[model samples]
Target: MNENLRCADEARTASVVELAQELIRRPSRGGIDPYGPVLGVLEEWLDARELPHRRLRDAAGAPVGLLVEVPGGRPGPWWTLDACLDTAPYGDETAWTFPPACGDVADGRLRGRGAADSKLAAAMFCHIAADLAPRAHELAGGLAVLLDVDEHTGGFGGARAYLADPHAARPAGVMIGYPGIDEVVVGGRGLWRATITVHAPSGHSGSRSTTVGAVTRGAHLVRLLDAADLPGGDDGSGFPLPPKLTVTAFHGGQGFSATPDRVDIHVDIRTTPGFDAHAAETLVREAVTALDTALPAPLPTAVTPVAAWPPFRLAEDAQPAAALLGAAAKAGLTVRAKTAGPSNIGNLLAGEGIPATAGFGVPYEGLHGIDERAHLAELPQVYAVYQRAVLELLGR
Candidate 1:
């Protein structure tokens, strides 16, 4: 590496790691913990650097995330670098080799809960925004570094707030700084989620009446959902993953003596372009209808749609993806465009008719699991790729 690039990498790595450690040490487990302390860490860092930023609030005026923007000299398409500050709840703390809040850098890895999943990326993006702010006069488009705290909660309040903000510039594309070095997530399966209520006649267990309990009906529904013939991926559609159906949760029944009247099952369907939300819903409703027909219930089954996001697959030549993929190739990085199995914020963006690249960062292990940590050896290369990609996108 040239002296300039080498120096930049060294400095960037140091700063990013330090900021990441500080944030991780604070413990911002999504929904379980208040976000103020963790958010404060990044806010303080931005304040020290004199970067322009503000809190993104939900409709109820609760801070969901932070937005840092660096506008360019000339008008061009706006771009975003997003990463979540909130993290998954530390499951089995005793199982971790290091404390969940250790945030220690040892064995060439940054060990912590949010290290791989996102806190590290948030720090990196903040530094990138700070670095670009001074050179904004030389670029065309603007850059927005979004540090979302509501991501792990599945609320995506920060992203929603940004998109809803009348004062904020509409981003032409977004690059979510989710960790994984090998693939640039260009698209993800969309989701159609709902709570299905199966109703049955309540009766005493001791009664001789042929009354079916909601639990039994719910089990039957689960079987039907599992047996439902969802279509596989259509190669012609360009989306590589098939539609997925998962019965995530079931709630019903109380005492063993009395049969419950109602049971609620949460169904999560991962949809593809070929099998979209509407198609998935129709299939699910048909299964419900079939179940109700076979085993008549006092009350009809109900399918309440909770959330829906359309699946999307970006072409290789698409903006943001094209720029990042090109930059990675130029940087001699083997990064392939990938469509993720699970839906992400990219799916939500797709619903808004906005394009986004979801994952591309340092390789890591134990994401959303025990010893979650990000390998630091590839930080410089990853940082360089993103920096190059952003510069290219901004017309620098």
Candidate 2:
């Protein structure tokens, strides 16, 4: 980049960090109304800049997504940069060394819940749009910054909202601002998150028949699922990561005294393209049925589908990936394509045939856990990467 652009980016870093901090202060947990107050920050920023953007709403009139466009200096193909307003829940607050929502800057890190997970990138995208707005005609096509609200729950609803928009051109490609700044995420494992509700008869804790109660049955099932060697080979064997399945949540027991009448277990299965969610669901049902019958334990069980996203893979030679890689190279940053564990909105975008949908963002720590943070000093470079990516993708 030229010294002028460098100076401009330097001037914007503080505001970017400030914006990220402000966003972190808002708690947009997973739900239908995720963007309620959180999106106001973006709206105010755009309003202050006199930039044109639109607010997307669900049927209930809640803000679900924000779309802002910066026309290029010249005509090139359209591209989008993706980020989300929602952050994973700050689980077990007592476990954090710092308050989860305070958004304090410490030891060159921004200590907050959503900082690393996405807020940092969201703030940077806004700055990128601002920077590019002045020289719009110098580039080809345009830039679309999509700050979505419904990513943490699963990237489905927010994606649907954006794709269904008639006014905006479906982006030729997408760049997801996610973690793994060192790696360009070319693909990720398929994922299925669902609820398994066990319908076991309530029995007293004082029972001497040695039969396990509902909670016990749930535990046993969890253990069974964990220990069982289920089938499904890895899709991309060359990639370092492989398929995985885990019981994310186990909720049961009404009280300490009485035997729990029901148990709800949330299962998350991550796979390479080889594993089909329907097939996985069948396996889970078969396992539960076999255990319920052979173990003489639970009376009944039911599986309810929650969410399923197929694995996403961008071709190695895709233009967006090439642009991103070139941008990283130009920025004097070393980056290679790899698969990340967490699934993002790319699954939906890639499924929709955006050939180059991929995840890229600033590096951070403690994602979805206590003391979650984003590297404060890395904000500028993140901007540079995105700027380079946008230029490469949209340059005339």
Candidate 3:
């Protein structure tokens, strides 16, 4: 990195660490209050710099989207840099080696909830915007910063709401700051949250086969689902491919004292680019129906789609992808396109024809779990890479 870039990177490092702490301090756990303070901080920063931005409000007047714009000298393809604001709940503070919101920097790592998962990316994007503002007039396309309020619970509410609004800003491409270690992630898998409920006539524990138990029926259904082969393919392959699915959660039964009357199983299905949600749902319902057939008395069962979000894959040769690859190469790293299990805002942008890719932040381990961290030492280097990528995309 050049000396100017290096100095900027160094100066932003402390700010990034501080921003991470400020974000974690609020305990923003998939709710409105958690994001308010952070958004305030961001707005303050943008105002200090005199950067133009707009607040996208929901019907309730709560801030949902923070749109910061850096207008270019000439109008062309607009590029958007996005990061989700909501984070997973910080569970069991005792399980953590350090306090969840302290932003403890130790042993070359920054540890805290939302430190590595996503808040770090948000911070980095802020720094990128600050650095690029002075040179904004040199660029060819618009640079937009989209900070979403809901992602941990699922991004549809915030992203879908933004997509639905006719006045919402649209970008030519979007760069999502997901957890990536100098690698270019061009694709991510889709997610389907489903619930399978099995119902049976209530019966006493003494009755063996007189009345079918919903808990028993649900167990049989789980077995068949375990045996069923869901679709999947290579780990790092790009789009237009077979998707993958895994049963993440299953719940049924009440207590040993009495047979449960109803059982519900929760499943998380991940589909590839070309997979159809209806077709996947049909396959799962069929499996449930087959399992119901084996019971002595067929139990009333229903398979319902609780939530569905499609997978997204950007073309490898797209401008944003190429620009990110160039940035990685310039940073002395090789670009590798891969798929992520967890869904992100990339799904929404890519679905809208914006060539968006995830992974443009420092690498870390134990995301969405205890002891979450980001390599503090590598952050400056990663920042430089992202800065270069932004400048390249904006054609500065």
Candidate 4:
């Protein structure tokens, strides 16, 4: 490894550790507004480094994005490294071994909510750009770092807003800093969030023969859904894509004494590459319609889509994918390309014709769960791999 590059890696690791702590200190739960201090700290760091950056804002004037651009001397492709600023709510803080925001460096690990999920990647990207600045004039392309504020809920607003900006230059390719060690993730699963509402006329429970209970109808629908089998496979190799359905929330009934007139079942559907949200919704609606026919009293049913994220798959032969493999090898890291289990902003970028991948950050387990943490020692290696990946994609 180059000595200067090694030094830059070490500095990046330490900086990300500190930055992760700073981000965790702010309660930037999804849907909740991000704390200004967190954005200010990141901006201040960029400004001090003399990096040209812009704050992407929404109509409400909320800070939705942070973009830093590293210009290249020669005209060429622009590459983007993106990370989300928002994190899931800290559940059961008492379950944590240390405070989520302590930014504590203990036993060669940094423990926090956003530590591994994305904040570490965001900080590391910044450091990598700074280190590459000395050689910017020799590089073949420009690099941009995009820090999005809304990812935990869905990246639709934050990501779409940035991509739609008239002044924003669309990069030839994008590398998303999700958690995946030095491995390149070339594909991701799709997401469909919808609510199945069952409705019936309210009546006395004693007269069950005349009145149809909404809760009962909802239960039937759930059973039908649970019993329904979607397409999936169990390829014993690794990370085989599987279809999943979950009832995240359910509510109905106004009072204990009355038969509930309405019941709502929130459904979360994860589909493979070939599945479309419209088709999935249609299947569910068909199931509900069939259930209504069998009921004693007719019950109205509807499937309402709350959000949809399409699945994305990039061919292994694509230039960006090939470049990632080559870069990882050059950086002395063994790499494999795979699909992500959950939906990510990579889906959006891939849809836009920018062959994108996720998992350019430090590897960590237990994401969105208690005891979330990232390996402190491995981040430098990840940074090196990403640095090489960017150079390879830009043909430097």
Clashes of each: 0, 13, 2, 0
Pull out the clashing pairs in model 3.
28-34, 243-272
Alpha-carbon RMSD, candidate 3: 3.0
Candidate 3: segments with Cα more than 4 A from true spot: 1-9, 231-243, 273-275, 296-299
lDDT of 2 by residue, 1-396 (tens): 699977876779888988989998988877734476788988999999977788876666767789898877665678988888888887898988988889889999988988887888888888888888888878889898888887787644566787888888788888888876788887776777789987666777777756667787788889888876655444444544566789999888875667887889999887565566876787688778876886564357888888887777776578788888877888888888876677767766766877554666777899888888888666677678778878777763
Each model's TM-score?
Answer: 0.98, 0.85, 0.89, 0.90
| Clashes in predicted model 2 | 13
Order of candidates by lDDT, top first?
1, 2, 4, 3
Ranked by lDDT, the better of candidates 1 and 3 is 1
Ranking by TM-score: 1, 4, 3, 2
Q: Across residues 1-396, which tens digit of lDDT does each residue of candidate 3 receive?
A: 699976865777988888777776766777635467777877887788898876777777776767777878876777878887777777787888888777777888878878887788888888788878887888887787777777777644566556666765577777788776756778777777788888877766876756768877777888877787765655354454555556666676666667777888887777765565775787788887797677744445888898776787776778788888778788787768776666766766666766678886788877888888888777877778778888878776
Question: What is candidate 1's CA lDDT for residue 358?
Answer: 96
Per-residue lDDT tens digits of candidate 1, residues 51-111? Answer: 9999999988889999998999998989999999999999999899889999999899999
Q: Which residue segments of model 2 deviate by more than 4 Å? A: 1-6, 27-36, 72-76, 90-107, 203-220, 231-240, 255-261, 295-300, 355-358
Candidate 4 Cα misplacement greater than 4 A, ranges: 1-9, 206-209, 234-242, 296-299
